[model samples]
Each structure stands twice: as structure tokens, then as C-alpha cells.
Target: MTLPEQGPLRLLALSPFGAPFDADEPEEVHVALANGEWHGNHLHPDSADDPVNALAIIADAVQETVTACLRQVWPVCAEHGLGMHPRDANGRLSWWCAGERLRRGPAHIRAAVGALDTLMPPRRPNRRSRRAR
Candidate 1:
């Protein structure tokens, strides 16, 4: 999608969430490499006004772009080996994993959306961590 104005979308490119990809114009921005191509619409102006909302929007858009353009899930859960989805976790947008019912714990968050590269070993969700408010 074409954004009437550019905002902090460049921030995504600087994080582990996205890498610098070529755009037709310097004013335009796109997410990570997908088959050497970038996809998805530009972030809306209002979402950029708030960090949390912006992250949620970015995570979803990135996932859509990657899945469609690259034909692959953007980030996969290490423990469950399933593709993760973004959900609000205590005001933070996080990657929620649908863990195995038997061996692994129930559905749990893997990590904050942009923190994949810096993730430590997956930890079981305790009552306290699960009930973030």
C-alpha cells in the first residue's frame, strides 16, 4: 500500500524484524527479503504514533508480506515447530506459539515480535509470566 507520508517504518529495517531491501524510491520502504523481493503495504500513519500499536501493525504486515511474497512463515516456533502469530502480550506485541498439547506446554508466547535474533532458550510460561497485565 502507498503511504501518503513516510514515518518511522525505517525502524523496522534496522531491527531483526526486517533488513534493508531495495525500494524503487528512497522515500519508499519495504520489509525483509522474500525471494529477493519485498511485499506488503506501508504502515499507516496513526499506527506509527504509538510504539505498541506500530509494532503490532508491523508484525502482521511483515508476516503477511513474508508469507505471500516469500511463500514461508516469517518466524517459526523453535519448540513446537509451528509458525507463530502476533498478539498483544502485556502491551507488547509478541510471537505466540501454539505449543504441543502433550510434551510442550499449551499455547505460549515465544518472544517479543522484534526480538527473535536475540532469543534465549524458550522458557515454560509460569503463572506470573502468563498473566501479564
Candidate 2:
């Protein structure tokens, strides 16, 4: 949290949702780093008036900080090495990739964000029938 403030990005201290500020959740929304040190953007202090809007805005802010300061493409498609982006798939914020394949076609999804570490290993085919034929 020691990081200096980024002036233009900061929003005012949030009141509560529906009380001149957010109304969705009780916890104060903040833009935090992986280490929990937040420097810029306060979630607009009003986005919590609507859950959907708040979620969208917060997601964008988090993604920006992680990708911009980390110097690495976040939530990347490990298989294809392509950068991932936020997309609403199946009513969830999913990490989407554009890796193309012959059978699978284009724009593949790597996995849900924060769940990429659990990707299943690639399956291998059996070669039993080719024995000395």
C-alpha cells in the first residue's frame, strides 16, 4: 500500500450502497495489489449502487493494475501463450483466449480467472493396435 497515489485514477471515499454511494455489499471496495496494497481508484464510491456495474468496474481496475505494473500478461493461455481478457461466459467472469486449433477452431477459453493453476493435463492416445502388424 506504500505505492504513491495516481491522482487522476482516485475516486472519493465510498459511502454505503444506496446512501449516496454503493448499496450492494457491506465491505468497502478498494483497488488493491496482489500484496493488498492499494494505490489508485476507489471503485467510484457509487458503483455499488448496482451490483453489475460495480463488478464490471472493479474487474477492469484490477486487470489494469495487474497487467500494467506486473510487466506480464495476466491470466494468459498457458497452452498458446496468448493474453487473456475478461469476458462474461456462463454468467461468470471468465478468462478468454484466442488460441486457434484445427479441430477446436478459434478463440478458446483457458479457464476461469484464479483457477488456472488447476488445468487438467493433456490426454494421450493409446497405441495398442499397432503392434507388429
Candidate 3:
């Protein structure tokens, strides 16, 4: 989908799936579906000026579209198996999830906004060989 040229938002939109860019709106950029339906406010011009704020704003807008239109959580936490929200970690924008157990800590940062793919992919262990052993 069409996003501002500035900052990591454009990269974030392309990383998960290559969201197509469109110029139909004329005045505003949109993060749209394959069918060209996008649900959220256009990226504010000022949001593109700052790296961290840009990511946060982009994440918020994306989440809004996914939740309202798609009817589900966008980037969910692997460990906690819950929806993640954009949170300011230090000066960076990160996907934050409430930790699974209270004793382990209240919450934790899963990954930086445009970096969710960096999390370890699901692995299927070699159960057949292990059982044979």
C-alpha cells in the first residue's frame, strides 16, 4: 500500500507482505489491501520526520486498519500468543507484549516495529529419529 517515503513505515509495510502502492487518493497515501480497501487515517506529514515516532504512527495506523477491517490482531506475540502493541522502548518503537506469567515480569518487547520477522521461526523437531534413539 502507499505510505510516506520518509522513515521505516514504507519498509514495514513491505516486509511482511508487499503491500501495493496506489495513487488513487491523490492527496493522501494509503496502506491498502489487494482489493484497494484501506481503513485508517492517512499518514500525517509530520509523522514522517522522526524515525521512532514515524514507526509508532505507522504501527498504530496499520493496527487500526487490521483490527477494524480485517477483524483480527496484526502482529501477535509468539511467546505470549497475544496481540502486540507498538511501544516506545528507550527511543525506539517496538512491539510490546505482556509477558505470559506475572512472576517472569510484567511485559517485554518482542521486536522492533519493522523487525518482527527477526523472531525465530517455528521449528518442527525430528521426532522420528529421537524416538528411534
Candidate 4:
């Protein structure tokens, strides 16, 4: 979850459009990047019935859009440097990495879907200490 300290915030949006198959249905929503660039199927309307399912669906769509449109992996594993995928970890959605740990097996959960910031260590001040000077 080490992001650049300076850059435009990469925000996500839900872009709504008429359902392609049926005009009578509710508008379909696609998870899009801040610029409205997205590449993925519209989120299933039924997913909204459950908060967990909705989160999973939205996360998948956002990942697809970021990966395809931006041409870079989102939420990479800090230890392995590999892209993580959303997975069901005991009924909780988590970011799972394929990279193996020394004794932890073939895969690991990097973090829960919306909790990456918790893993980031607090930043140290930039000023040099008196000992260094």
C-alpha cells in the first residue's frame, strides 16, 4: 500500500448507464477510474442486496478497470511485488497474493479489501537529526 506521496488522487466512481439489454431495467453501474476510463462488465444489480457481495463486485470491477485501462497492477504485494487478487478468506473478502512465504505456504492474504492503509508503517520525518549534522 505504498503509494506516491504526490500525485492526483486516483478516485473511483460509479458510472451509470442504461442497461444494454433492457431499457426498462435500472441503470447499470460500472466502477470507473476518476477519469471515467473503465474496462469491465457492469456490476450486477443484484449484488447491491448484500453489502459484502456489493463490495466484492465493486472491487473486482475496479481491479479490472485499473489493470486494463491503466496497464498497471493495483494493490501489489509489498513483500512479493506481485499483483494481489480478491479472494474469500473465511467468508471475508481479502487481497490474496500468490507469492509464497518461507514457511507460510504457497499463498498469503495481503489485506482485507478496504484495509490496506492499516498495513502501511507511519512515515518518518524528512529532516536530518542533529547526530547526522
Which predicted model would earn the best TM-score? 4
The collision pairs in model 2 are 1-37, 16-22, 17-22, 17-23
For candidate 2, the per-residue lDDT at 59 reads 60
Model 4 clashes, total count: 0
Per-residue lDDT of model 2, residues 9-87, tens digit only: 2323445542565555554556656455443455676787976566667667766665566554555576777777767
lDDT for predicted candidate 1 compared with the true structure: 0.65
lDDT of 3 by residue, 97-122 (tens): 98877567679899988777557564
- Number of the predicted model whose lDDT against the real structure is largest: 4
Residue 74, model 4, lDDT = 83
Residues forming the 10-long window of minimal summed lDDT in candidate 3:
3-12
TM-score of 2: 0.52
The weakest ten consecutive residues by lDDT in model 1 span: 1-10
Q: How close to the true structure is residue 32 of candidate 4, measured as C-alpha lDDT?
A: 63
TM-score of 1: 0.62
Clash count (model 2, backbone only): 4
Clashing pairs in 3: 1-19, 1-20
lDDT of 2 at 55: 60
Candidate 4's TM-score: 0.70
Score every model by TM-score.
0.62, 0.52, 0.66, 0.70
lDDT of 2 at 10: 33
lDDT of 4 at 91: 84
